[model samples]
Each structure stands twice: as structure tokens, then as C-alpha cells.
Target: MDKPTISKNPTKKVASADHKNLSSIAQYLKDAQGSHKRSIPPLDQWQPKHCGTIDLKVLANGEWWHEGQLIKRQAMIDLFATVLWKEDDTFYLKTPVEQIEIEVEDEPLFVNQVDQIDIEGKTYLQLKSTTQDLIIVDAEHPIFMRPFKDELRPYVHVRFGINAVIQRAAFLHLVEMGELSENAQGETVLSLKSGDLDLHLGT
Candidate 1:
């Protein structure tokens, strides 16, 4: 498949249009420093604030770019992922003091690794994201697939209202683990069950 074309100026241009919000978030991030070991911040309690958007974007392949430049620091991406928050229709990287809107080409996160574990006849799928977050496929983190022309793209809920797109490698692994089964109307389908949730891949 051809690589998706990207425009790096869009995000920064948006932020430039609204200097108030843009500067606020940028200043907060520049000054804020601490270990990101804690869980996701309590975003629901944060009152709506207008922090301008950033040039930061989460690409389709799970790459984070800033100002049209690739953010090569995995540590930086992981740190930013911890603070991802969504309010209404906007996605943000929020800290206690400020919040900055970010552009996401697809889902906010990308699942790059997957492992299957079987115990006592039950199978569990463990997914690892680009940010190194571990997510288990269960009722809480159900999988959904959307069609992209002839290809179907899969996504899974990561946390705090953020969803991670399952990349090609991990998706193929899931397909390898899929088992053929007959669904409710006796229609044969390829399905995979993790925890208590059963997902239909395809025929």
C-alpha cells in the first residue's frame, strides 16, 4: 500500500490562528516536569478550557509528529500518551494546569504487538501499544473494525476514551489465532474470543 500523505502545517496553523489557547498549552508543557508513572489524569473533573492546538499529530502508522518533524523519542511519545484526554469532540494532551488539542490522523494510539496466552482451555489476547501500554482484549476493551476500501482496519479502546488502531502485524497475529465457527443463523464465520467477548473477524 502507498504511504499516506501528511500535512504537518495544519496543526500548527490552527494553533497559530488562536494564539491564546496555543500559548497556554505550550507554556504548560514546557514548564511541567514529573514522572509519568501514575495512571491517566482525571479529565472529567477538569473544567473546559481553551488551550490552543499543537502541531503534534498521531499518524496512521502510530508515529507522532510535531511541526512536521518526526518525534523520534519514544519516551516523549509515551509521556504524552499518558496525558491524552478527550472532551466533547476534541482530543488533548492535558496536564493539571493546561490542555492542548492535538491532531490524530486515525486513532490516538496504535497497537504494535500482541501475545496470546492459554490457561485451562481459555485464551487471552494481550496487546501492547506503541506507547508500551498493555491492554487486554475483554468486554471493557472490545475490538471494532472499520472498512478502508478493500482493507478492514481494527481498533481497540486503550483508556480514557482513547482508541488504538491495531497495526498490520498485530492484526495478522489475531487472524492467525482466529477459529472458524458458525454464528447465530448457522452462518460460518472466523471468530476470536478473548476474555468473555467474542469478535467476528470475517468468513
Candidate 2:
């Protein structure tokens, strides 16, 4: 199989000719964070023009790449992850002023760590992504089983309509925390509970 590659010299043009390169975009994103508190831009309100495609891509293994080069810095990855947006079925790196399309081989994120915590008297599952994005398993961020290759795999909702495929180890941990029982149809079901939210892992 041939490996995907992008030009080392990426020169994609955008509506704003002044902001022509990824470096400017990166700087803008960094500057946008005026305070220490971490938060995403109100992308819902901003109607930035669609900037042309970029060489950035998120591989199936949850690795980020730019111009065919692997992005090894976690801080850079986390910064880019914050701007990931999905429209219809395509994924893009969105900014307050512009958006650029990017390739995603599979799910854009991965949940590699999970912990069980008790809030008051209710139990909750806390999931951490590779980028350090924390998500709580509940009514909004639910887990579902999806077919991957020949086997069923677990996936959880992250944010902004994006989701993460639960890693094997974390999936095993969830199974250990779940309760197995026969459902109304007499099918074996594995379930987990968090606060008032009850979820079925699989059957």
C-alpha cells in the first residue's frame, strides 16, 4: 500500500490572501486564547468563509499529519483538535474567520484512558482522549458499538458532533465495570450507569 503524502511546501490559497499559510493560522489560534482558561470559539455563531483545502489529516490510528509529516507535538495537536468541526459528513479545521477541509481516515479522536468516579451517590465514567480532552459518559456523551473491520468496536461521543473510538484497553475496563444481564428479548446485555444515565454497552 502506498503511504499518503503532501507537498513539503504547502501553498494553498485562501479568501484572505494575507492569512495565506498554516503558520499564520496557528498564530491566530494561539493569540485568540487571551486568557488561561481553556475554551473553544463560538464556531456556531461565526460564519467564516470556506478556505480552500489544507494538507492536514487525521489518520485512522488517531495520528495527526501535516504535509505528509507526522505532527509529534501533543500541544500542537491539542490546539488543532479544538478547532475540528464537522459539517454534513466532511470534517474541517474551523476558525473564527475561515475554515479548511482536512482528511480523516476514521474517527478523528481516540479515548485511551477511562476512570470511574462517584459524584454524590451516582457513579460516572470519565474518559480522556489522546489530546487530553475530558468527557463524561452520560446522556449527552453516550457509548455505542460500531462495526470495525470484522469485529464490533466501541465508540463514544466527544464534542461538537465529533466522537472517539474507545481503545482496546479502555474497552476492557468498561466491560469490567459493566453489569451483564438478560434483556427482555433474552439477549445478553452489558450495561453501565453514570448518575441518572443508564447505558447499554452491547449485547
Candidate 3:
């Protein structure tokens, strides 16, 4: 009876285990591919921001104006970027993009004004308020106006880059539209081409 004992077969058990592992691996690969296919490009990725009528106005005047009110200052208007923040301790003469809350004579007043221009035959119907004492900021100033630090922390400089890209797109659009022409002093003059007049409004 001792000589009749037989060893148990382990081959079948090993083969079954290996088959499951291989199937699991294949499934994992399939899942990975599916995830990759469904992923979307990040917002900071290089892309063009299309220009609208407002952008055209900015390109024309180097600033965005509404109803004779300055919606955004020219220097603050980046042909290639957005303002992240205004540098502290510097005399940022340019208008701030953020909505400011001010208390005037114990009454809170928001100083946000819109700049509108009605298009009429390639020219603009301009209507704006008087800006007699407004001080314009120089574009060549040493002070840097960046976006809010907290809002763009982990991705330092990305916001600025994105803004710059958008501005460049707008400029390119203006050039393609034949709205930009070279001047005698090598400066760019943004004006409507002949026979393409439209209404314009600026701050």
C-alpha cells in the first residue's frame, strides 16, 4: 500500500493562476488606453483665443473703451497676456482690472463703467464721458502688473503666458483683417481700410 501512493498534480492549478494574471494584465492595458483617449487638453495648453468686436476696438485704439469710459487701460491691455496682479508699492497708474469696492461719503459705490461702440459702415459711433483729469500709464514703466498671487500660485507664470498668447492672437486677427498699417515712425496704426468704415466707441 505504501508503494501505491501517488503525488498530486500541480500543473493544472499553476496554469489556471497564470491565465487569470494574463487576463488581468490585458484588462489593465485596455483601461489605460480608454483613459488616455478620454482625456482633454489642459487650459494652459497653447491655443488661440478668438477676437470679437471688442478686441477689434482695442486693437484700433490700443485700449478698450466704453461709453467714453475706459474699460481697460492700453498698457494693461496685453496684446499677448492677461493681468494677474498689480505690483504692490508701485504707482500703478493704469486702471485696475479687478472690481474695486469704495466707500464714498459713507455710501458704497462701484466704479465700473462700460465702453460701447456702434458699428456703422466700418466706422464706430463713439459715445464716451469726458476724461479730463485721467492719467494714462506708460507701457514702458518698470513696474510689473501680475495677476493675483493666490489665484495663480501653484502654476506660477502660466496665467501670464496664457494671457500673452490670447493677446497675440488678437493682434494677428487685426493684421489679417487689414486693420493694422505701418506709420512713418514705424508705429502701427489701427484703422479700418477704405470702403470698410464702421462705428467706433472708446473710453
Candidate 4:
């Protein structure tokens, strides 16, 4: 079945009065996000029955929305980000108790920053996500670019099949780090090396 069509802007601009109850939602977000830290939930090991879909949707820019209202709390976004998983092209919010599907406008997570590290002369790139998760770009977690509208956008696999969109600034960093090299077939290519793994960005 086809997924529901999301509006151009996933967050609809409701009347200002709609925000009168932000306190309650903020508290709910804080409770969910701040409730647990130190250790991540074992979502990979979770085997729960699939629950019905929810109105939750992750926007292309990494902001979240519920029932057309923006989820403006960073703590809440961080909380939901922890439980996110992707099966094929579908995104899910899973805990030990249950799993429910959610819509994603673009890539689920947004990678806003990138930094390079050197370990015994081996360089590795680390990605910092808006959700405060750090990921290493390596063979297991590689970078890719796809056409978005008229331009190409880069993304990297963070974890559990969740792809993080490399934003403008980080995209520039990745490009600056790229080196012009040759492929196995001696074809000219542009690639980035991280931890002894050379990922071809483009030819």
C-alpha cells in the first residue's frame, strides 16, 4: 500500500493558540527523552508485535511533527531518535513493548557536523548528528548521495538502517576531505578514506 502523502511542509502552521498547551507536550518529551540515559535500549534484540502507524513524521531537516504540529523540544526529538529503526524503506519507533511505523520526509536523521580523527596514522571521519549521536564513517557505515529535487544530497548510514542526511556545512567538509584518485579499474574517482577504508564519493 502507498504511504500517506505528506504536505510540502510537514509542519502545518496552526493558530498561535494551538501552542497554549506546549508545556504539557514539553513535559511529555522530557519524560520520554530524559527518563533514560547512560545506556541505549536494546532495540535490535527487541521482538515486539507491530503496532499501528502513528502521526509522527521526521522532516527532511530532522525536525519532527505530530498531527501537523512541530515537536519543538530537542529533548523529545533526542528521545524519539534513540528508538528509531528502519526496516527496508520503512521507519519505525521501537521499544521492548511495541513497534510502530512513522513517516520520514527525507533521511531520518540529519548529520550536521563532521570531524576527522587520526589513529596510528589512519584517518577516520566522525559524524555528529542533531540528535547528539556520533557515528564513524567506515566500511560498515558508508556515505552515499542521492538526487533531492534539482540537487544531490549526501547521506550516511548511522545505525540500525537509519540514514543521516549530511547537511550543507558538513557536505562541504566531506567534499573538502575528498581526494581525487583512481578506482580498481584505474578509472578516475573522488573518494574519502576513513580508517583504511576508501569510500568512492563519485567518479
Candidate 5:
């Protein structure tokens, strides 16, 4: 199934904050974002000081929570996502002034939608996250299975050491679009291709 592309607007203001603690962080991000001309921030150029940790967490299911309260506004989440930065194994919400550590249960993002697009004569799989990040299934953005709980779950590289968990529905979609075949080791594997990039869905 084809999903709509990510929005190009970068000037959307964050939604009104319901939690006082989150409001402070949200305000800092908003102010730091002064005029967001770029769709994604230039996180590489930003080297802000560490501002300690916050009560923010991204749950395994891709829901964002702050101070034990679920963050329900998509605008707020999108705003926060623009500043998402990964250093080593820790995830942080970064700004021009400072960076604050946040906990991520699994991957920091989730692929909620998948689209199969025929570009010219080649078939390509496009994955979209809840925060409007689009990742093409290719060598640079390969999908691999990771152990979660007792089962293996699919994940894909997003950008700069950040990965997105493939939601079950999206994983099933990829399975339906994949080709079943035997690998070199005689093990059955479902293979998917995007242009010249080939990947085994789940072996």
C-alpha cells in the first residue's frame, strides 16, 4: 500500500504543552529552532553542551512519554523529533543551546507505514516513521532483525546511528512483497530488493 510522502513544511509550531516539565523543554527546542528552513536540522554542526537528562522516554511501541504522561500531540512529537540525536548508545533531544538525554526502550522511532514504489523499471520499498522520516530500503538503509522480548523484530537504519523499528504491519507488508528462496547455507530466507540493494527480511 502506498502512503502519502513526508510533509515539507518546517515552520509548524509545536502544540500547546499539557505538562509543565515538558513545556520547558518544548519551549527550548522551539526557541532553538528559530527559523527552520531545513526539513531536518543540521545536527552534525551542532555541538551543544550536555544539559543532563529529562523524564522523556520513547517506549518500545513508539509512543512518547514525558514525566509518566503520554505525549499525545503529533505536532509536539514532530517538533522534538527534528532535534533527535544519537551519541554512542544513548539517545538525546538536542538543541543549539544544550542536549538532554532521553531513554529509548527499543529503537527511537517506528516505521508505521510502508510503500512499494516503481521508480522507472525498478521496484523500491519505502518506509515511513511516525515522525515523518522516510527511509528507503537500500544498502545505506538496510533492514535487519533484532531480538526483542522472545522474538526477532525488524529494524532499519534511519540516519546518523539512529534506527527505526519496523512495526508488525509494515514487516508483514514487506514479507508479502518479498521473494522466498533458499540462501547459500541452504536456509530459507525472504529476500527484498530496492534497485541494486538486496536484503533478507527474516532468516
Candidate 6:
């Protein structure tokens, strides 16, 4: 098998031509957020199945039986895990909320976090960084300590791709409810009666 080419110094080019399109993409994200509601079903309730493991040959060729070129199995699994599905067969790589989860050590911790938020005060937490360490948590380890140490045991971990989608959707939903704004510079500027806080990228 040929080792996949890894580029170390890829060129950095500004996408000046697609600024308007990028703005539209941003708007789409905001719209998805605005349209989202808390009443949506949770991940476990949705019953998303593992759908069985698929090999790289089948994925790249869209056929069940093929002896075509093969990529590393790990790389293929990573690619498949990041993909999003629109219909039963249509697949893309964007994030969606139905697949996301917010995990806490206990119900009390979850409640405390929520209670810390002031009434009518907006709070933001970045799912990406919070779940980054758990991306590869060994299920055989204790859930609470898995984030800090590499242990072997079955543990529960949140799906970050889904979380990112949900957070973005929620933020945009607030804006549509007249709670936030996007400035001309394409920055998501939010407003609250109590005052506004510029949300840090990962927070």
C-alpha cells in the first residue's frame, strides 16, 4: 500500500472570491440554529444505530464487493465517523444536533452548571475542546476519569461532531429569536438586555 501523501507546508490562500458565498454559509448556520428547538429528541431516544462497520474499499467505491485500492483502516474509520447523513442514503460531513450529547460527571454537576447561568444571561461552552480529549476514550475505563487518563474500560463519551452542530444551531436560534446579530465583518455579534459577551472561539 502506498503511504498517503502528507503535506507539511500547504499554501495559505485567502478565499476572496467566495466571501459572499461564505457569508451565505454563515447565514445558513444561523438559520439552522434559529430553527432548532429544545423539544427535539435526544440521541439515545433517536436510536442511531452503529450501522455495522464498513471497509474502506466499500466506502470509496460505493460497492460491497471490491478489491480496489485500500487506505489505512483507521483513516477510513475516522472519515466515516465524521460524515453526516441527510436521508437514509445521502451522506455529507456537516454536523447535526440529533447526534450530539452533553456529558457531565453526575446530575448534580449538570444542574450546578445550569444554575450558575443567570436568568436572561447567555452562556456559551465550546463542545470541541471539551470533548477533544475523549475522542478516543477507551470504553473499558471509568467514564469520569477517562478524560484525564488512558484507562481500559467501557465508558460513555459524547459525539462532538453532533455537539458542534447543536451549539451552532442553538446560537443561531437565539439570534433568530432576536437575541443575537451578525456584523458586516461576518462576526457573530450577540446582544442581551444584561449586556453582551463576545464568545471566545472554543468557549
**TM-scores for all predictions:** 0.75, 0.85, 0.18, 0.76, 0.82, 0.20
What tens-digit string does per-residue lDDT give for candidate 6 at 1-203? 54322222234222233321323333444465464331222223344432321111222111212123332343222323333333333232232422212111111000001011233455332222111222221232111211213421112234422211123343344334334556777774444221233321211
Whole-structure CA lDDT of model 4 = 0.74
**Which 10 consecutive positions of candidate 4 have the poorest summed lDDT?**
13-22
Please report the candidate that would top TM-score against the real structure: 2
All models, RMSD in angstroms: 4.9, 3.7, 27.0, 6.6, 9.2, 19.2
Model 5's alpha-carbon lDDT is: 0.79
C-alpha lDDT of all candidate models, in order:
0.72, 0.80, 0.24, 0.74, 0.79, 0.27
- For candidate 6, the C-alpha RMSD (Å) to the true structure equals 19.2
Candidate 2's TM-score reads 0.85
Models sorted by TM-score, best on top:
2, 5, 4, 1, 6, 3
Candidate 4, residues 100-183: lDDT per residue as tens digits?
A: 677898877898899998878788999998888888888889888778777778889988877889999988888788877777
- What would you estimate as the lDDT of candidate 6? 0.27
Name the regions of candidate 2 deviating beyond 4 angstroms.
6-21, 181-188
lDDT of 5 by residue, 28-84 (tens): 777766765426778999888776666677888888887667889987898888788
Sort by lDDT, best first: what order?
2, 5, 4, 1, 6, 3
Candidate 2 positional error at 37, Å: 3.9
**Candidate 5: misplaced stretches above 4 Å?**
1-20, 34-38, 182-188
Global local distance difference test of model 3? 0.24
Q: Tell me how many clashing residue pairs each candidate has.
A: 2, 0, 33, 0, 0, 12
Using TM-score as the yardstick, the better of models 1 and 4 is 4
Which residue ranges in model 3 land beyond 4 Å of their true spot?
1-166, 186-188, 192-203
**Residue 171 miss distance in model 2 (angstroms):** 1.1
Model 6 ranges with Cα > 4 A deviation: 1-24, 32-142, 147-156, 160-203
Tens digits of per-residue lDDT for model 2, 57-111 = 7887788877667878787787778888989887888988788878887788899
Superposing every Cα of model 5 onto the true structure, what RMSD results?
Answer: 9.2
